[model samples]
Target: MFMCRGDVDSQLCHECIGNATQHLSSECSLSKQASIWYNECTVRYSNDSFFSVVDMMPGFYMCNTANFSNTKSFTPLLFSTMNLTADEAASDKKKFATNERVFEFQTLYCLAQCTSDLSSKVCGTCLRSAIKQLQIHCDGKLGGRFLYPSCNVRYELYPFYRSINVPSPNELAPQTKDSISKQDSRFLEDPFYLSYNCSSNHNTITSKNFNLLLSYLVSNATAGKLYHRVIMDEIVYGLFMCRGDLPSRLCVQCVTNAKDRIFSMCLSSSEGIIWYSHCLLRYSSQYFFPNIAETSPMYRDINITNHFISDQNLFTSTLSNQLSELANATGNSDERYMINSLKLNDIQTLYTLEQCTPYLSPQECISCLNDMISTQIPWSFLGSVGGRIIYPNCNMRFELFQFYIESDEARSSRNPSKEAGELFAQIGFILFL
Candidate 1:
């Protein structure tokens, strides 16, 4: 059996299913019952009669361990959003619904689904069970996923899905940080795990030579010249929009600096990604955009202390408000913004950075930033001193301490100043965010 969200892109859907099938077939060949999950789809095979029946057996729940700032308000809001999305999904023919709702200033993204074969009631029950299970397993998590045999529920702070109803540029604006974070909760670390049809082109390599050439350039070029040269070579075409926000010289320098570190850390794999405090570099022959490929490698620092707060809800809620304000302010401006705030415990501070590709309209930039913020909040490592969201088109990050250098002149700040009005508009006609 296979299940997937209806809203996912066709190519991504197929790729996800294909991976699940191949993995399950090989990994569980002898077992009578087994299931495999990818970032985009899910596949299962069982000897017990489960084709039409809603089986909640073998359920799984995964959640971020971080606590929220305000438990009372956050829990109710979270439950309500999940319940609403699940109902919509159960009633819909495709068994999928992507929803964004507001709680205080925070916006939450949620996805709920069931196998197409199951009845609405069964799906609802399965989702409820999954939610209940998450309470025990995930508790005060920033994000969590509950998977059942017939149904599933995912809630997060970011937009994990590419909606079928793509918003027009005018309608796209930076949403509340809470909303973004909630949406991110639903995004699977691997989008291919959901249910969808697989195709022959699922994992086709699109540009092997180009990626190889870019890797070679990254390896040979000095840190200062590497970024511009890569862009000139068209290897970083997607990143071109960020040029206006970054100084031409500094942009090249940053890319070069990042390349040196990334090459040393990630090596020159044709299909790997290397992330730095300032930038991210991914060179994959496999096309990752539009189709929702989730194979990008992830790394988390384990050195940060994982101290749990006594009041999880308070921490999360407060953080959500702060993030929402930053997102809105940054989204409204042409330039990017960074803000750092101390938590209730003076020992720790929440750091945030928001940026849009120079090409994007303010609204588009906001929307993209909102999506990144939502997803990162959920998957962020517990007790993480730092976290980041690096999309092909846009990027954002936050850390406990200042990892980026800020120029004393203030005019040459690492992140563009919010006070700089319409910086992108003055640069070019094309919107890059």
Candidate 2:
């Protein structure tokens, strides 16, 4: 596989890739695996295929010799900037992103890129692991970069690449090795993949049957089914559940994107799960419908770089109480999903969303959520502007902004004070005193 830094022009990207490949082949002729990183690109070859999988071995690191004097403030700014860049790269179809932040008087330029073959979740995870390397080896440095086979991260005190002229819709077409195919550039622009898990064991028959089931699920999604499951013999089962609030069009788009990426994302693992912001899709060798899913592969994310609560104790208790209400509401609702907004103050409004695999029994749904709330919440970041714990069975998220589209009823009751009052009436909630 080959990848170029996001800012490199197409002609430059091609030239660098060609040079790296020539040098690596001659220098490591006898080796089974070899990789070369140039200033603008990376070229890698392995005896076994490694597309879409995150790999950290055989890595390299570089940093500026100088150190920053303002480590205290720069630390947080660095974390915030890199994280923002990583999120954008992971969500983009090109699997590339850049960011610029002004900290005090100095400007920080950041870039993150993943191999095009990686799913957004895997890409984000890969970049994050690479980011950790910065802290370990290059702490207090003015600039640094981590280079790996699957992804690379770089940050500097000055601009190191092309100008980040914001691209319009027409310019988004993939035109180089550094971009995704034109077919992928559509539909996938919006649904941000969150996480994924897959079993290593692969079965030929199971994979074949699972593909058929996936087609079925996609068909149902096109037909506007909010949730659907199929048992394709005793060896393969598949299902998909769109977030309750999304329109049928977005649901179909996210489900289709998942189908296209799941096999490659899992490295052809027969049983796999992929989560996008708009939908969740999973398939397994054993039937798992109507059962409380094991939370072994749960994922959590926190917006630590964003705003944090001023009153930690009060916000903690309030958030806990709000999530509990959402859990209860989701468990008992027909859709197995709930969204709520609680006004913390004029400047801060806490929005929460909770959902389960629709087929689960109400009790099972609540149990799954309660378990996550008690054991998995990122308490250290609980006072941050946003955070979430996601399990295969259920997931709960809390952010300072509303992340979902409001329904007709919510629009009708848009009065701020009335909405706050109705929150208590509907969920039997009490004001945080």
Candidate 3:
């Protein structure tokens, strides 16, 4: 049987399931029994039936490297909260519970859940065991989680839960992934060919209004307003998005630099898009946020060292599929970004990334990614080892080697000067920010 983390939002649960199934099928191809955990979901299957059985073997635990400010008081409170949540979860038919405790400086959140198949007695036992494991393995940490096959427990000082603000569109109106897919043709127009008839109504704005707009870009965009709109005779719609994986400080700096550069480059034009090393900024006199996924007012950049490959078709096909999967995952993920690695052959690996501005709806993100895949990227970058395609709403890239920063070391390696140099180098070439 397959069971994912049941405490997450239902859509995230399904997305995690998809990731686990795909990964397990690929990574554990020959195994008769396998279990895996993604950040938001878990999946396990075995040849023999194990329903309602408490399987604790092969469990794992992780803790935040950072410790709380006041552990003497915090430790007791954390355990008390955990025990309360665990007992409630064990008794509940759904086998899940959440609790929060207000501390002097911050609030602590805890969650506990057991597989629905487990009986109340067995669930209680499993949760108690998980609590012990957490104590032994992650004591004194600010955040941590322990996972067993039957139950899982987690606590954190941060709001790790999904925000109620982004209400599930399904709750508002019945919509399934299939229904979203069915609307593809309507949103994902042809990539190779597109037609646009622009109006000549370029309503000129005063210098004062333009300066105000630029101020808004620097203030709001640098402060993390990924989407903003200002309307006059001609509406000024703006979007600035940093790479989803970047640290907050770097994201702020990247957007700030781009805002300054865009004023110099595109101040005269009412519609313009600019790309930086860590961010992308675009503004227009036209409103184009929620529906810009289908359009292709975009660009691309390929690595100069495009090594030749013997099997171009295989490479292209593999890359396309990977990018598509990443697109789907990113749209569904809370962060609107995903990283995946694919083995092109014995010697080479393809690292791929897909990201969308968090402001876009999940469906729009999917459409934007599909539109990129349908573009001439496959043909244009067929033999190239690495390349990126960028649009305003979303972007994707692939390389034979890992080019993205996935760790603290990678993020810290770049100083502000290096960031500026990289951005300048790509100004006329491909902007990969």
Candidate 4:
């Protein structure tokens, strides 16, 4: 397989491929499987089947000689910028993306790409892996890159990529740090397709009924319904729920993305569900409406900040109080959604958001949130500064800094200012495989 970076012009791509073919054959001629990455293109050939699959091994890492003047200030910026860029690359038609972030006295350029043969869902996962690996090998470096058979990521202080492809941050007026973080989170939310799942069963008889159930969902989505549920022929049950604080446009986008992704991920299964940053779509052969049973966590993430909490007991105690307030507060709302913030210590403020499916009663929602506090908090966080847990009926997230907005910020968002905070804000994501 041979592939060019999306931004590379056809002529340059042709030259790069020619050079790669010659170099790979001469250097690794005896090997049945070999990969080469040039400035403009990547080429790989394997004896085994690899197309459309994620191949992560036999990778390389590059780090520049220079180091950042302030690793403390640069860590979060690098994390969020690379994350957004990875998401964009996965969703783009070319399976490639580039972005710019204004470092204090300099500009940071980033590029991410995946082989076009991979699906958007897998592409996102691959690029995220590349980012983590790059950070592991090149923390605080001024420039770095990770190259794999299926995906790659690079960041530099200089414009190492074509300028025409990336949007210029210089054109915009200066933004405060808080505003910049909000913009980053907004960018993060756009291509934030997380994952999709389903039960491990397939039935030819129920497939037709499931299609009909999806049609009902499509009609609701067309009519701009943020929440809807329907039962079809007593065989298939389906529903979709958008985050209550989202605008109609984003709710529509989230639902549409989920629908498109679900068909790709779980079409043959009797039960299917896709989760995004702002919306969730699900269908099942079993009836689960208006129920609040405790289910295992479908997905979880922890932002690891080394030595963040001086007192583990106090940290857990403080977090418990905040989560209780958040659950009680959200449980009172008709929307069944709420945003909250409480200063855990002088070190940092803990910001949290919680929500349950609207069909559930407030009491049921509270019960669900209570279960989250009791079961998830101890097993998941592990003294981390940030964490999130997603279940079938409810989800919640908390961070040392604000990671959400009261409303969608597509054109309109806030980021709390950070006075003095700890370093190393790398977040780890785990799906129940």
Candidate 5:
């Protein structure tokens, strides 16, 4: 059996497999049974078939060669993480697992993997054997890996695994305790507003009234209504919605940026919508909250890199199937959002994302998505490689690459202030039209 380390990146896994095969053939040429382990992969060959069988012999243990001075706390946490990781790998469909645990001084990352051919019970037994071997041979080491013909486990202070490649709105800004506090304050104390019937009294509604309404809306967000509304002074109706995936900190920054930009740009319009990468801020004199229909304005952005080929029925059909499935899934979910994917070949894949404001019922969500698929989306877009269509209540998007990170994946920040400012400037210029 041959297996790659579960935590290794794809590129390294391939390279390590090649190296392991070549070395194992040369080093163990006389033996009837041979196995080799590399940093990223393992290879084994035997005269007899070893499928579905647990083998503990010919095991190897390698440690970091450096001893940890802080073994008292580190040993307990390391062993605990190893046991938990073993359980996770045994239960998961992949028979592989990675975990990170934080300590007072640093974080520990661990991975456990068994050959896919093993049964869950057999895999669990193999990992337990490997863990015991690791403890006996490398208990006080800074890092170590125990390798057997059927399973392997490793731990390190630094991250080693390649995480799923999904982009998220939270990437625009890092979450910090101070940033979370600042975001909460910004939403309550400052809000954008427009008066429809009272041009004369537009200036009459004091800043206090706007703050009070915005404070209510902000509170709604804390309660998990990312899309929420409030009425101010019995006149101004305001609504704000954060992207469902955005963290609280980025949500706040995005909304604050929208509010500041909209207020400065559209000073007295009776209706307006400010769109950001992670959120939307809108205010209107007319009631638009809980909009169940698909009549709200829509936004579209398309990728122009590739067009459909002449003989691409398989590709087109696969794309449509995935998108339709995502639409159905999103409509049926409590969050009203879902992601789906389809593989066209070894090299090409399509990913789709669809979402609706949670206020909409399942039927309303379905209707809203159907309207976009039929009317708003152009036929030519279906031939393109990627595109996004965003709406107030519902939005649908498809691309050739994965775009959304799962909720549990690790998150990192990318600065978005400059781009957001530029977008606000463009929207401001368009407001006059």
Candidate 6:
């Protein structure tokens, strides 16, 4: 068996593969055949013949078992998403792809993979077979996975693969210079807007929010920020956030550029959010809190074990309680999440994190958090815990392990100007008292 990182970039693939080869041999000493998979790559070697030729003998097919309401519509959408993703993977040297398609407002996440060694035709064939196997096993279910010797495909209601790099839709769509200028003019005229009436005179902006938004924007806008512009309207407000790890100037530039791009795309819509692994973009005409909305659309790669938790009830209760506490504590605070580990038994630990946006009221945060926990706890998420609840004003996410950067580093990297703004607000409040 062989397992490689789903997000391995072309430059680092060979290095990861080499590391996996060495590690697998040492870790599985008694077993002549073993496979180790990473988020960035995979490696496996078996004493038995398991290369070049596709092997379906020891494969598994699992699905949600609940059939789609409209098979005809779902089937075509599924096929299209698969085809698009395959074309992308085939063209790219990494041998991986991630894509999402919508059916009746439901998002379907699909990931396809072929061994780096396979020819395009062979890769296509292997993926097709793997997909067919999923249909046989999962039938009408909302999610399924098919794994074979040479290739694999997985489809789920939520994203599974992490950090797939693909060209944006705007890149593929043709636009003349005149059209581009017109679009830019329209975007600048009426950009996304949000209204946050200051509840108190002492209320001030925090560097944390600016930092989060800036880092998120930079990661998405790798080209540069000078080409982009920020547009604020009366009815709707737009804020683009990049990953927190980026350089300060780069983060600002990324956010600026993304705001321009987002304005161009969503100028007509009243509410929308588009997020990349590195940045998050949000715009809303109405206050959207304590209300369920899918504004910020983002994806991450997650590798769940095939094994199920030994004690389902205990795990569920523990996770739920932790989430509730986090929600209550994170209200209107820059540090909105917490991650820690608990020893389950001698060999296993339940590592978890609970996070919410800093803008939400405590009650609003808890309600939103509970809704997310309810959806994920009931599902058999490959023995892994993962879920994301997107709202207009705030969002909440939790997993069994640490998937995001720690809060300390995130806080330290805030904009100095924004930090001063927060400090000023605090001082004003003390003076008022």
- Candidate 4: residue 347 Cα off by (Å): 7.1
Provide the lDDT at 145 for model 5. 79
Q: Where does candidate 5 clash, by residue pair?
A: none
Better of 3 and 6 by TM-score: 3
Model 5: per-residue Cα lDDT over 361-423, one tens digit each:
876876677556534543322334465666777877666555555344322221121110111
lDDT of 6: 0.48
Taking the tens digit of each residue's C-alpha lDDT, what string does model 4 give over 1-433? 9988776567667766786777776777777777777656788787789989998887788665446679999978997999999999999988989887766644667899999999999999999999999999989977778988899998865445654522331222122233222333432457377667777888443555666777688678678887889887766788988766666677777777777777667777777778777778888777788555445527655543334222223344345545654665566667777766664444556667788888778767766775566445542224344666777788887666666655444212222211122111111111111
For lDDT, candidate 1 versus 2, the one ahead is: 2
* Per-model TM against the reference: 0.44, 0.51, 0.45, 0.48, 0.44, 0.37
- Cand. 1 TM to true fold: 0.44
Taking the tens digit of each residue's C-alpha lDDT, what string does model 1 give over 81-162? 8888878887888778877766544456678888998888887788778878877776666667777768888776644554
Q: Give residue 196's error in model 1 in angstroms.
A: 46
Segments in model 2 whose C-alpha atoms lie over 4 Å from true places: 1-189, 204-207, 303-312, 380-383, 409-418, 424-433
lDDT of each: 0.51, 0.69, 0.61, 0.67, 0.61, 0.48
The 10 consecutive residues of candidate 1 with the worst lDDT sum are: 424-433
The number of residue pairs in model 1 that clash at the backbone is 62
**What is the lDDT for 328 in model 2?**
63
- Candidate 1 local lDDT, residue 432: 11
lDDT of 3 by residue, 292-345 (tens): 464456766643224422221334434454565466567776667766665444
Estimate the TM-score for candidate 6. Answer: 0.37
Q: What is the C-alpha lDDT profile of model 2 across 64-129, one tens digit per residue?
A: 545678899988899789989999999999999988776654457788999999999999999999
Off by over 4 Å in 3: 1-203, 224-235, 303-312, 343-347, 408-433
Compute the lDDT for candidate 4.
Answer: 0.67
Clashes of each: 62, 0, 1, 0, 0, 27
- Model 1 ranges off by over 4 Å: 167-433
Candidate 3 TM-score over all chains jointly: 0.45
